[model samples]
Target: MLKSILSFYYQMQVFMFNWIDVEKLVGLFSFEQYDPVVFGTSFFLFYFFAFLFVFRILAKTKDLKVWTIIFFSIFFYYKAAGIYFLLLVFSAIFNFYIGQWIFNSKNENFRRIIFFASIFVNLGVLVYFKYTNFLLEILTDLQVGQFNPLTIFLPIGISFYTFKAMSYVIEIYMEMLEPVKSLRNFSLFIFFFPNVLMGPIDRASEFLPQIEGDFSVSKEDIGRAVFLIIVGLIKKHVIADYIGLNFVDRVFEVPLRFTGTENLLAIYGYSIQIYCDFSGYTDMALGIALLLGFKMRKNFNFPFMANSVMNYWQRWHMSLSLWLLDYLFKPLQMGLRNMRGFGNAFAVLITFTTVGLWHGANWNFVIFGLIHSVFIIFSMLTKPLRTKFYDKVGLANSKVVNFFQIVFTFHLLMFSGVFFRAISFDSALEVFHQVFTFMKPEVFPQFLESNTFIIILIVLGYIGHFTPQKIVDKITSLITRMPVVMQALLIAVVIWIVIQVKSADIQPFIYFQF
Candidate 1:
């Protein structure tokens, strides 16, 4: 009996040990889980509020609050990217110290060297993880010796955080802002989980000041945060994911199988799909930041409302566009100011090219950026001509004229967005050819009938997007003004509705891949 009992105990211990697969646990905590923490996930929705509860308790003690928030942010990032959280901490430490050194160094020459070094280090890590494979492909195509691809997993949000680091160092080098005294504050700025993954690329000047203040939440702030969170959830799960799963993914995956009319409509669907998907992420980021009593810059502004390509860029991805304007376009344009029109055109072209390359390591993204560059440059060159024509036609201030321009500008973006969405140059070319040559008008009705649900969602998305700014604002204001409990109920309802509509598989935010 004693021997049998001992054998049973040994078997139980073996079973318990087998249950814990060390490799699997390591993978779980590593970059193996590529999907970042997003708004709609159960883990986030539940834990975020729990975090807020603890945060509220700590709010009275500013230092404790800051550290608590930092800890939570790190944990949040860990969930999203697993063990790659170490990269985040390393970046924070590296940048914080480098920024301090740059600011403290008395010699301008040394400061300049450190600035360049900072840029090199930050951008080098980014390019290695993001672009190595693309570069290898290019080399392979050129037959420039044998190149083996490296199995490097691109960490989520490296681009945003790298830019955050570079911006911090660049500003310090320029003497624009003082180096932060507290490492905690600087770390919070870089690794603040909400805006880190996808960003309005919060400027240190704008964000750092908030960190020093006492924490407080107003009714308006609560309302606005809840409103944005609900809107973001609907945009992601209800509209973006639904349209993607039903229409956009199917059409893009096998464009050749669909009719030309289907392909053309797919482009339109993608325009709305990407807008809803990306803007959804930004909305959630903004909302989450607001809850933390931090304000992020607006990242989107109803881009479809723009009347020209130049106007479109200003509205779409406003943070990145403005970043390019401030750091890149202004500097290059200033240097080439002597060249006049040629310089302006050159700067615009180069800026968009950088913007394209920043999106991903694809030639397709390059083409996508170039397409916008051409449109914007053409718009610039013809600005006077367009003005003259509008004045000649007595339509300079005409609502009708503005309407047509908005439509034209939107379609131009949609056309460029094909390259943005396509897997390769040849695929984009095939799409272009299909839309131009094989467009069959007769299939529209049947396609609509077959895809009535998706068509409704797509139409609704555009309607919401193009709705007058004032009406949307007023609606948002009213929604946000409800009592706190009512707001929570509203969010609960939205989440429940999302549950009903969401696809079986969660679609990661489109921008998370960037």
Candidate 2:
């Protein structure tokens, strides 16, 4: 028993501490050469310790609490982003101070300069990291490889938090918010751990107030939080992880090896996998924040249920989408108000492409973004024709079009997601070819042979379907009615499950790469 206990602790330590200091490692090995496993492991351990150490120090100190949080946030952000975190801090501090500057500067021209500078500064960093590779390929194709080599790793969450900071700047420019008087709170807004990676891409107006306001947690709220975390765990580790291991990763790694149906299903699985993976991270983030006496914006809202591509974008990664709408789309939308037809189309393409390119410094991400832009643009263009077509068919209100619309949208997403998931343009094209080529009668039978996983997935779907809302409503309404002892026992069970089930296979959050 003693030997077993020691062995357990040893495994835990290995799991936590496996990967650390990537940019440092990359210095020795180069970026492409390091093991993904080692990098992920080091990150897990670094954040785990950082989260614990910061929690204890901040919990005990009032004077240094915010600063302590900010300090550790920077440290962990550094670990997560490598040296690129300097850019994150630079943006945050510059925006924090600039917002204050803008608020105080009553002069119209100076105010305008500050606002423009702030926007330019934020977007410059985003474009530099997010678009560098894209532009590199463009220049290479243009036979101009004279671009300076940038060996710098783009920091994690740069896209998300850059927007968060920009929103702060925008609000100041719009006279909607005063600059943060305290750098501590302002830093906290940008570096808050839960929303740090692959944000719901929270806005300053939404997140800042939560951190500043008083928060209370009930016993049932705790239970609800526990439930959300568990659900999130299953989504990420079980469903997403299994599919990733079994199909999506495999096919993408060697797309020509699989059939059309297999590739198609894998693509479908990946759409769910990514949604489950990403939104699962957000859920865990929210749940963790709840436990810490805070709230975050909901990142997803049953996006698959949307009837249109535009509606799908609105529902998915809502914080990021809304950020784009407020900062990117709306400005362009309003600016092009004078030039209606082509201008609107250009804005839609540019904004959605930017949204796609924001995902990575890759050509595939560009194509993915462009595909989505086309989806939205074509949807918008054909809206009248679609309405008229549905009416003429007398199926406007019929369940058939509704059903087909959902299916069509899901397929559109799956089709585009192939590009999103692929390692290269060729890989995505190969996956598409396999998806078309593998339509034999035997494929479906062979696929459904895994009754165990299918049943488990089905039950998981049912549980995931209703448990969250039911638990949240119940706990929110009747927390006081349940004794603390009961809540404690429930939470204990969840904690145990989290511990026991987290074996050697705890997959890192998928979006951590971006």
Candidate 3:
């Protein structure tokens, strides 16, 4: 009996050792996968709470906190983009030294050269990863020696972090801000992980100080954080994913398969899907940053309520839009200021075209930008005539007239979204063709009946979007006062709803690609 027991124990030990390969175990914990840590995943949630315990302890120690965050952030980037974490390290060190040099330099010509050098390095890397294939395709189309596209691996968050790095140097060159003294502090600012992937695009002027300040989170802050997280989860999982899976994806995937009415509805559905998807990410990012005792700038402000293309840009993706405006549009406009409205028109066109290309390497994005620019320029040029027409019709003061204007603007933006959401330019044109040529009013009722749940959510999403800010603030204030147990229960309820409404496959956040 003793010899049999010894044999069984020996066999069990061998099985355990062989089953768990050490290398595989190490790989799982390392950057073997492209699974970057993102919010709203079960694995991320577990990792975050566990990390939070250690983070809180280190938070009181400034240097320790900064280093700890830097380490974890690097690790987080690795999990998200594998070895691209090294690219982040390279960016941090490179930018830190360059920014300091630019700041400390006294010679005007030298400063200018350094500034352009910074732009070249940052944009050069961006172009290599993001536009090599695009430029290759263009060469092929032009029959320029038939060069094949290279297999360029775009590191995740390259666009975002590169922008962050460029802004740091640019701001120093402009004398708007001083260079950060500590390399570690600068690294923390660029790679806070919360706003690193899809960004509110942290400004050095804004984010740098928070690293050195007191690390404390107020009760209201906790409430706001949880509220934002819940709102984001609902928007992403419940509204965006649900509608995309049920309606928009199908219609967009095969535009000709559906009737014109369905295509139009799909356009409307896509506008909501993108808003929920993007704004949901913003909510979670802001919430997570708040939990960490850092505040992120607002990225969305009820963009769908905008009454004009210009207003839409102002509200939607405010971070990127404003960045382009200050750094890109303003400079270009200044260069052509003598041309008056023509200059403004030129700058607006150029700026938004860049904005479109910033989204992806596609002609569809270019057309998307072009369409909005045309509408905006046309509106600006004809503003006086529009105002006179409104006065002549006695509709200048009419709320009903205002409502129609809002609807018109919303639909115009929705139309532009077709190109933005379509898989290709041909697909987008086909959708437009179907809208005008094959719209069947007779099938509308059946379609509406079949998509009742989706319609309800769409309506609710918009209503919530357009709801007064004060009302939202009031509701959030009340939530902040809830007992811990109640908040826990509310979270449990949210998770249950998410589980119930989630699509079969977890769709990635739309903006993560950018």
Candidate 4:
């Protein structure tokens, strides 16, 4: 029965991905004759059943069930992760063995050789895929030796999983945790389906240890998982997609066409759009992991509420941020302990710059990263003045200060985001110039009129900021208490609604290509 189930699962995955031949698929699907629902439904159903199969297999792992599931999980990832699947598998195997070798080997030279190779091999992959093109473009303008661009498809989660693999090695080497005994357990940690495509990327210490234990399901846990799934659904389809497709996307595509006020509103809309899109993806990932009886860590903590760049890092993309703090920030801080204040400042700047480059290979990402480094550096330089001002004003936590801090951070982050958003530096500057020139109070109303949903999205987006993670879980948990029949009925209605509003143009997850 499991074999048949697995076979059926694999077959559907192959069929849905008919995109391995993008040209052939496009040729077959003439617009006049195309049906978007057909493709979307195929994917939605494929994932749903795949989840069911994983649940069933995981429920009983007497033989090689875990490995079998891992096989298909990689197979499943291919639909989304694409060529990155090979890189993920290789990185996992590399780290898994290196971690064990380092832990078990007596030969100092061998361990160092393997360990150094693991770091560079993994980082080299990240650099090549994520930054190669960005570098080539810069070199081309400099009239350096002709920058020959070799077209490469970046593996989807290369940055995420590579960082994860690095964390594993560093943790193991540092004696923070022991290495895994089984390759299966290690691979599962690396390629766990829930966090593979988009992640609150888990560490081996936190995630792998749990895998070695028993498989027990809880009703309360089940309830929270269900609720998380629901919340994730609402965030993605209702909030992110609804606003992005209807409003934010339209304005950004043609910034010059809009008035100054419209440009401002459009930027505001994008700010909301990105947060919703990214946070919504993380929520869905977390909720799904919860359903499968795994607890992924929090990735976002209402980052906009944060007043300082340092504080913002604490709140946003927390998994990635925390990963950096542990692996990069702390190490640099500790390493530079002997240096004067200048050393500490330099280390912080360098670390944050690396943080930006980690996102992508673009110069804008570098600038985006550098902008934060500048904020951090400036704040550090005026540390005494900052503390004095706060003490004098009796307003460190005052409402007005909080509001302006938020406003200032929002614009600061927004401009950096614009740099990140534009295809090139010139485009970014054009948007900046137009942003200033297009000014008119009337533009706000016109922009709002054009994208009314976005204004509502912004309000709802902030409301989301206040909800505690615990409550989000508890709420999701409460929903799971409904009878299975009712639960199915609710899901059915949601599926129906999703189908009704579905467009023929199926936009892949924006981050998937990266």
Best of the candidates, lDDT: 3
Off by over 4 Å in 1: 1-32, 58-60
- What would the per-residue lDDT of candidate 2 be over residues 37-143, giving only the tens digit for each residue? 22123344355446656664445654355565566566556555556667767877898889989999989999999899878878888888767766776898898
**Clashing residue pairs, backbone N/CA/C < 3 A, model 4:** 223-477, 224-477, 227-476, 260-438, 260-439
Please provide, for model 3 over 1-514, each residue's C-alpha lDDT reduced to its tens digit, 9 standing for 90 to 100: 9999999999998898799987866765687554666688776777787778778864567677777778778888888888778888988899999999998899999999999988998899889889999899998999887988798777887888888788888889889999989998898988888888889887888888888787679889988888898999899888998899999999999999999999998898899889999999899889988988899888998897787889888899998898889889999999999998999999999998999989988788889889988998999999999899999988887898777878899989988899999999899989998999999989988988898999998887787688899988887888799987887788778978988888676678888888
What's each prediction's TM-score? 0.93, 0.83, 0.94, 0.86
Stretches off by above 4 angstroms in model 4 are 1-42, 57-59, 62-65, 81-84, 107-110, 468-474
Go through the candidates in order and give the C-alpha RMSD of each one to the true structure.
3.5, 7.0, 2.6, 6.5
User: Residues 1-514, candidate 4, lDDT per residue (tens digit)?
Assistant: 9999999999988887773676756533322111211112445456556656765665476335466547656755666545556787888788888898888878878877877888898888888887887788888988886888888766676777778788899888777988888887888888877777667768878988777655455776666655555555556666667666776676667777666676666677677667776776677677666656678888888888778788888988898888888887777888888886777787788888887787777677788888888988898889789778998979776889878988888777787778777667776776777778767786566666775766887768767766777876666656768877776676667666655544434444454433
Clashes of each: 1, 6, 1, 5
Stretches of candidate 2 exceeding 4 Å from the true structure:
1-68, 82-84, 146-149, 389-400, 450-505
For model 2 the local lDDT of residue 82 reads 59
TM-score of 4: 0.86
C-alpha RMSD between model 3 and the true structure: 2.6
Give stretches of model 3 more than 4 Å off.
1-28, 32-34, 58-60, 388-398
Better of 2 and 3 by TM-score: 3
Model 4 worst lDDT run, 10 consecutive residues: 31-40
TM-score ranking of the models: 3, 1, 4, 2
**C-alpha local distance difference test of each model:** 0.86, 0.72, 0.87, 0.72
